[model samples]
Target: MAKRRLIKALAALLAVLAVIGIARAGGLYLNHTASYPRGLWQKSGDYDPTHAGEHPYVLACAPGKSVRREFIERGYLPWGFDCDGVEALLKRIWAVAGDRWTVTDAGIEVNGQLVPNTQPLTEDSAGRSMPVQTGGIVPVGHVLLLSDYHPRSFDGRYFGTTPIKDLISEVTPLWTESP
Candidate 1:
C-alpha cells in the first residue's frame, strides 16, 4: 500500500512540474535587450498584428541552425537567455512582408530612407571585425527585426530577415521606462 501511494505521489509531482513549466513559458516577458524599452511585457499568444513602418516588437528565436550556430559562436546572444535551444531575441520589426530593406556601409535603409545611427561599424567592442550586414527583402511570412534605440544592437542588421513562424509571442508593453 505504501509503495502504491509513493508511485501516485511521484506522478502527481510530475504533473505539477509540467504545469509550472508551461505557465512560466507563457508568462510575462522581460525586455532585457536595449533594442526595446526596458520593462516587463505581457506575452500574448497571437500572430503579429504589426504593419509596415510600424516597427512593432516581438519575441523571436533563431529560425535556422546556421543562425543559431553563428549566434552561439559570435556571442551575439546576451548571456544566459537560452529559450529551449535558440536564445530569444526581442526586437522591433523594421519591415514586414513586401517591404524592401537594405544594409550597406552607409547604413540600414528601409523603403528608401536611411535609419539614423545604423551605419555599420567596422569593428566591434571586442575589436573584432563586425559581422557582415546581410540585407534582405522582407519576404512573405518573414520580418526584418532591427532597432533604432541601440546603434550597436545585434539585430536584423547582422542576422538579416527572420521567419515569422519563429516568433514566440507578440509582446505588449505592461510596464516600461524611456530609453
Candidate 2:
C-alpha cells in the first residue's frame, strides 16, 4: 500500500511539471497583457494554421515595417501598431483590396449593407473621445478588418484600414473543440 501511494504522488508531480512546461513554452501566461489572444486549439485535423484569415485565429507580429494606426476584422495586437507601445492583437480580415468600402457614423458599409457591431463609439472605456473615420474607396494594397463578435471592437471602424504589406501571417487555432 505504501508503494502504491508513492507511485501516485510521483505521477501527480510529473503531471504538474508537464502542465507548467506547456504553459511556459506556449506563452499562455504572458498572452493576456501581451495583447495577442492565444489560440486554444485547431478545429480540425485538415485545417492549416499557417493560412491567413482562413478562420478565426491569433496573429503574431512578424519582423518587418511596424504598422501605424489600423485594425481589421481580426483584433490587432497593440504591437501591430507602433503607437502607445502596446502588445499585438487578434482579428479577422473582412475586406481586402479592390473591395469597395464606405465609412459612416452608423458603421462601415461594404457595397451597401452595414457591418454588424460597427456602430462607432463616442468614447473609449476610459472616456477618451473616439475619432470618426471618413470612408470612401478602399485604396490599393489595403485590407479592411473587423470583428462582428464585439460591437466595440477597435477595428476598421476606428483605425480605418490595414495595409497588406503590414500583414505577417494568419495563425490557426492551436486547438479547438468546436468546428
Candidate 3:
C-alpha cells in the first residue's frame, strides 16, 4: 500500500509538470481569476500584437504603474504573473478604436448601448476610491476593455481605453468553468 501511494504521488507530480510544460510551449494560459472563467485558454495564432482592438480578449500589462500597484496591493492581480517586471491583466475588448464610450450612473455605454456589469464604483471593497473614467471616443491605438463577467473587476471603466501596444497576446478559451 505504501509503495502504491508513493507511485501515485509521483505520477501526479509528473502529470502536473507535463501540463505546465505543454502550456508554456504552446502559448496556453490558465485563468485563475474570477474576472473570467477559471480554466484553460490558448493563445490565438501569432498576429499583429499592435492591433489590440482586433482581438476579443488580451493579456496586457497594467495600464499604468500606479494602477498596477493598486491592483497588486489590493490583491486583485497575482504576483506570479510578473512579466518583464510588469504584472499581467486580462481584459475583454469591449469597444474597439473609434467607438464612442461613455460612463454614466447606470453603467458604461458603448455607442449608446449600456454594457452590463460595468457600473464604476466610487469605492472599492476596502473603501478605497476607485478611478472613474471620463467618457469619450476611443482614441486611435486604444481599445476599451472591461469585464462583463465580474462586476468588481478593476478594468477599463476605471482606466479608460488602453493603448494597443499594451496587448501581449490574444487568447481563446479551451475549457472553463462558468463564472
Candidate 4:
C-alpha cells in the first residue's frame, strides 16, 4: 500500500511539473510575438497615449508585451500592426535617423518636401490602405508612422507621430535558414 501511494504521489508531481513547463513556454512565446526586447522582460518606459501636443512618428500597439514567437517568425511586422508595419518601422527609422524626417497632415515630408503616400503595402492579412496627415512639423527627434490600412488601423492617423526616444527595440529574424 505504501509503495502504491508513493508512486501515485510521484506521478502527480510529474504532471504538475509538466503543466508548469508548458505554461512557461507559452509565456515565452507570447513575449516574443509582442516584440519585447530579446531575453528577459524589462520595462521599456512610460509611453504617453497622448502625443503631448507634439507630432509623433511611431505608432505602438497597445499591450505591447507578449511572447508569441510564431507571429515574429511569420514576419508579421509588429504584433499589433493592423495595417502594414508602417507605424512600427517608421518609429524604428525615426529613432535611427533623426531631424531628417517630418510628419504632417499632407503625409510625410522629408527635407521640407512632401512624400506622397505610397500604395498600400500588403501583409499576409487582407486590408485596404488609407492616407493620414497632420498639420504640425515633425520635430527634430521625431518620425511620423501610419498604418498602410488606415481604416482598420489605430495608428498615426489616430494617435499622431511617435518620438524617436520612445522606441524599445527592432524585431529581426532569429534564423534565416528554412526548416
Instruction: Estimate the TM-score of every prediction.
Output: 0.75, 0.56, 0.80, 0.31
Model 1: CA > 4 A from native? 1-26, 79-83, 134-136
Candidate 4 or 2, higher lDDT? 2
Global lDDT for candidate 4?
A: 0.39
Q: Count the backbone clashes (under 3 Å) in each candidate.
A: 0, 21, 0, 20
Best by lDDT: 3
Q: Which stretches of candidate 4 lie over 4 Å from their true place?
A: 1-107, 112-131, 146-154, 175-179
Give the distance in Å from residue 93's predicted Cα in candidate 1 to where it truly belongs.
0.9
Model 4 worst lDDT run, 10 consecutive residues: 28-37
Candidate 1 overall Cα lDDT vs. reference? 0.74
Model 3: how large is the Cα RMSD against the reference? Answer: 4.0
Per-residue lDDT tens digits for candidate 1, residues 1-179, read 99999999999999977875674576776676676788788876655454445666678886686777767777777543445565588777778888788887778999888876677777877788876666767888888877777788777777678888877777778899976
Question: What would the C-alpha RMSD of candidate 1 be, to one decimal place?
Answer: 6.3
Q: Per-residue lDDT tens digits of candidate 4, residues 1-179?
A: 99999999999999977875674454311233222222323222333424432323332442222312333444444444332332233232221223344555555455565544422233334343333334265565544554332223333433444555645443333322231
lDDT of 1 at 71: 71
The candidate, 1 or 3, that scores higher on lDDT is 3
Q: Is candidate 2 or candidate 4 better by TM-score?
A: 2
Reference-based TM-score, model 1: 0.75
Candidate 3 lDDT over 1-179, as tens digits, reads: 99999999999999998988888688888877877888888887532535644537777776777777777777766775434464467778888768899999999998898888888899988888887988899888877888888888878888888887777787789899975
1 or 4: which has the higher lDDT? Answer: 1
Better of 2 and 3 by TM-score: 3
Deviating ranges (above 4 Å) for candidate 3: 1-21, 46-55, 85-87
